[model samples]
Target: MRLALSGVSVRIDSSPIVAECDLTVEDGERVGLVGPNGSGKTSLLRTVYRALDPFAGSVALSGDDVTTLSQREVARRAALVAQDSTPDFDFTVEEVVAMGRGPWLRAFESTTGGGDATITAALERVRLADHRARRLSTLSGGERQRALVARALAQESPLLLLDEPTNHLDVHAALELLELVKDLERATLCVLHDLNLAAAYCDRIYVLHGGRIVADGPPAEVLDPELVRTVFGVTCTHLTHPVTGGLLLAFSPQQPVRSPHSVKG
Candidate 1:
């Protein structure tokens, strides 16, 4: 499914966060959102998932206005695997995954056999099949991240909203998550901090600064060293990766590197 944000602005307690911005994730594309701290990347995602409504303009899914749909209706179309989304209590892994079916369940309806099957399959997809009976709180951070992803998968939504989905994972696990998302046949809007990973996996990228889109295009076009220095206030050695032939970035602080002997010793 396609996601379009047209002239969208967001505010918090009367303070503007995101200005009128136009962005889109074409059908079956994996789009990346990248920016420095406080750049409103997460804020824009919240607006897309309807957690926070835009102060101006609109967000549409597959050409339908999201505002026209109820929250449950929206859940049926978009599943958010956010950075801070954790279960309130100690729910079993399967139980947590099954919650993704909330949008499909009617009031007073219990989960049917097929629902159990779906949850099981979701766990397996995320490689957590053996942990199905484990308490969600008992898992490590990376394990927990995978379980949450499994929950989103169980939702079976066309548009997946992921805000830093690799936060708690180690390097290998982080790469694995990106690979998994790339293999998915769904539209994904992911907020990523690592520029190299963004370049490796995203079909396109949008850079945000001070609540507005500063630059956007394919990873190579948008992640130029000059743009990185300007927006992120950091210098980077940008190059084509020798192994993957993708973009490679090594960042440093804006100031010149200090020599150990130059400092008072």
Candidate 2:
């Protein structure tokens, strides 16, 4: 699936959260959205899944306007993995994944044979097949995130929207989760705070700032010291990894160097 946003803007209760933003995630591509806090990344993402209608412009999936599609139709085409998707109820992992079949079922209809197979396949894809009976609340943070991804997978949507899937995870877990996402090979639009991780995982990146997109391209072309200083107010050093030869960034506060002064006794 292909997602395209053209001149999209978002407002909440008369407060503008995003300006006219244009972005695209092609079929089977992993595109990353990165910016400082409150830059409207989440708001833009919400528009794609029809969670929040764009105040201006259009969001299209496979060239079909989102407004023209019903909520269930949209749900059938796009799946979302939100940052705060943890359930309060003690639902079993299998039950949680089964919810993804909702868009296909009619009123009061339960999942049948094929639906059960799909749910099981999703769990196996996330490597959670053995824990299908476990309560979601008892799983580790990374495991819970994977379960959510499994739910999205069960939705069988070609387009995926992920809002900071690595939040609250340790470094190793974060990398593991991103690796799993990369392996899915879905058309994904992901919001990420860690620029390095985005660079490593995303095929292309769009940089948002002040409710507008400032730069976008492959990670090697868009991420640079000057852009980092201007957009994030930090100094950045670019390095190449020895093993993978991927881009790495080291950042520091943009403080001035001070001359040394001697103190007299």
- Displacement of residue 137 (Cα, Å) in model 1 is 1.7
TM-score of each: 0.93, 0.95
Strongest candidate by lDDT: 2
Which portions of model 2 show Cα errors greater than 4 Å?
A: 112-115, 256-265
Q: Candidate 2's residue-wise lDDT over 62-127, tens digit each?
A: 999999999999999999999889877898999888888899889998864434889999999999
Q: Per-residue error at 107 for model 2, in Å?
A: 1.8
The segments of candidate 1 whose C-alpha lies over 4 angstroms from its true place after superposition are 112-115, 256-265
Question: For model 1, what is the alpha-carbon lDDT of residue 217?
Answer: 96
Please report how far candidate 1 places residue 118 from its true position, in Å.
Answer: 1.7
Instruction: Pick the TM-score winner.
Output: 2
